[model samples]
Target: MPTLALMWEAKAAPGRAGDLLAWARAQELDPSPARREHFTAPGERVLVITWWPAAYDAEVPELPDPPQELRARPVHRWRFEQV
Candidate 1:
């Protein structure tokens, strides 16, 4: 099975970063060996990287979904295949 790396670049509304992170943590979807990292730049923008098994990609699950409020912000996503 190949590993999949999911990358997200987004900006949070004022004082909403914490809420966004909380929503991300509360997701209940299951992915083997899943991992997540969060970063903040000097601006209010946030970067999140999530990884999981690529075998499950075709299922199009919801754990990867972003918060509704954050969804309105500019977001970019990419998937990388592991060698």
Candidate 2:
């Protein structure tokens, strides 16, 4: 079967970057993914990526949204299939 790359990104509010990072680190996805990675950027942006061993159009699961108080804006999500 093909694999899909799922990504979720969120920007933290001022001075709340560390809190956001900690929260992201503690989150666990249900129906677990094949592989996962996390990243942090300068503007307190946090990203979570998971590789799922399923078809490109599969109905893969997603992580829960972070609390409103922790984010600068809404979260963003994307899905991609390898070439």
Candidate 3:
């Protein structure tokens, strides 16, 4: 099986970055281990990266559903195969 990575870009609301970080941490403990990492400079932006083993089926099972709060923010995702 191939390794799949999901990447996201988002901007946090004014002084809300801490809340976002807490939420992300809680999410990592879910059934799916989605890890959150980012750089905060030049602007309040966050990048989320998730990885899982890919499947041959049309749909992937390891990938977790996006959180509702994250949906409210401007976000983008990209799927990539491991090198």
- How many residue pairs clash in each candidate at the backbone level? 0, 0, 0
Number of the top-ranking candidate, with lDDT as the measure: 2
Q: Note the Cα lDDT for every prediction shown.
A: 0.64, 0.90, 0.54
- 11-58 per-residue lDDT for model 3 (tens digits): 566666656555554554334633435444435566667666663232
Across 1-83, the per-residue lDDT of candidate 1 in tens digits comes to: 77777766666767777776666566664543377777777556666677776653544343455666764475767767777
* Residue range 16-81, candidate 2, lDDT tens digits: 988888898888878889999999999999999999988788998787789888999999999999
Residue ranges of candidate 3 with Cα displaced over 4 Å: 28-30, 34-41, 55-73
* Weakest lDDT window of 10 consecutive positions for candidate 3: 55-64
Cα displacement (Å) at residue 28, model 2: 1.5
Which of 2 and 3 is ahead in lDDT?
A: 2
Where model 1 places Cα greater than 4 Å from the true spot, the runs are 55-57, 60-72
Candidate 3 clashes between residue pairs 3 or more apart in a chain or in different chains: none
Shift of residue 71 alpha carbon in model 3, Å? 8.9
lDDT of 2 at 55: 79
